[model samples]
Target chain A: MLTIHTKLISAMITQSLKDHPIETCGIIAGLAGSNLPLRLIPMRNVAQSENFFMFDPQQQLQVWKEMSARHEEPVVIYHSHTGSEAYPSRSDVELAAEPQAHYVIIPTCSPHKEEIRSFRIVDQMVIEERVQIVRQYQPELEFQMMVA
Target chain B: MSITVIIPTILRPLTHQQKHIDMEGSRVSEIIDHMDQQYPGIKEKLVANGNAHRFINIYVNDNDIRFQDGLATSLRDGDVLTILPAVAGG
Candidate 1:
């Protein structure tokens, strides 16, 4: 099980909203052990839908390549529902092809309020998992993680 | 009582393009075995040996089977089993 910093996740969602108001999604890749350390890897947007996302295969491969270069595997995938609950729609569940990765959704249903949720997409099931975002700053950083 | 198993698009090849299949079993494992018998080689897409594919996620009703008994998860009459893919989009 991986644990993500809630504050970092919040920042990602907030930035995603601004970057792709229509709908935004990305990947989080990191080491699988200790602190469950992770790095958010933004993916191509799954063009807007009535209440779902349509993922892009080409982008997926690109992200996969990037992770491979860094020896990091995709651990979670995140998207935003501009005006719906942070839950997987029937379509979302049907299209989840990577069972090992987590599906995270950021719901912008309520104006001025943003909500983030994470789930595990198993064959025929969507499992909600626990996520934590920390609030701290470590300047003079040697490693730079992308949040766009 | 038998339940209907909904096969996702990615898995339709295993079911000959049938979206829904009916089977009878008290546990998920039994249902999988039943499917294997009905459709030769179907088990390869679902379970490997006595375990399930790491990417396949099973759900009873709307809850994830992982939180339940996994392959041993129980089923009741009229329950719905959905087999979905692990999609990676936005």
Candidate 2:
């Protein structure tokens, strides 16, 4: 399962819509090995193709350096599908490099309605997972609420 | 000069599951050619028609080779080379 902040989801959807016809791609970085996504980094689709997207190489390099300096990893690698369903395409499966990162897909074909989904693609296999959106991640509050 | 080449997970199988490999080359293309010699079938995945594949992104010491000299990008002895696919969908 994947747990993400609502604000991040909102930002992703907004960006996806704003870049309609061309897919938007970005990474949500978090503490290394923490598995907690906290940062929403919108990236440029250098390909700028309606059928595909590719991050600007220079920008990607810079972001990667920043993430390394901050001791972070891409907890959530996300992109939008403007013409297809929220499923990993053949190329997506072939290019999935992060086995530990959650692959989030926001389908904006209709623009009126959205179906967001997350998957784990490792070695050409795609496994859909549940997503829990929270306004805030409060591990301490969870225990207190459980006891209350 | 010897450089460290970090292989991405997708290409790990072709690399005998090796994550990192040390090879000798001064230019990015030379290193890629050497890698292909060591692990057959890898060059095709990384290069196509004498150019880095459209989906492949190679970086040297945190800087993308595309912004530099691409396949002709020069390397130093302790430089770290990373190969990753372009993250995209839709």
Q: Which candidate comes out best when scored by TM-score?
A: 2
Tens digits of per-residue lDDT for model 2 on A1-148? 9988777788889888898888888998888888878777888998797777778877877787688788887889998888888888887787787888999988888743468999998877899999999877777533322100
Q: For residues B1-90, could you state the per-residue lDDT of candidate 2 as single tens digits? A: 999998866789999999789999999999999999999999999998998897788999888787899899999999999887777654
Instruction: Estimate, for each residue in A1-148, the C-alpha lDDT of model 1 and write its tens digit.
Output: 4466655577667755675447777777764332343677665554555354544544454554466567666677777777667888776776676566777788765753466777888786878887765544344221444454
DockQ of each: 0.12, 0.52
Q: Evaluate all candidate structures by whole-model CA lDDT and list the values in order.
A: 0.67, 0.84
Q: DockQ score of candidate 1?
A: 0.12
TM-score of each: 0.55, 0.81
Chain A TM-score, cand. 2: 0.90
**What is the TM-score of each candidate's chain B when compared with the real chain B?**
0.89, 0.97
Q: What is the TM-score of chain A alone in each candidate?
A: 0.77, 0.90
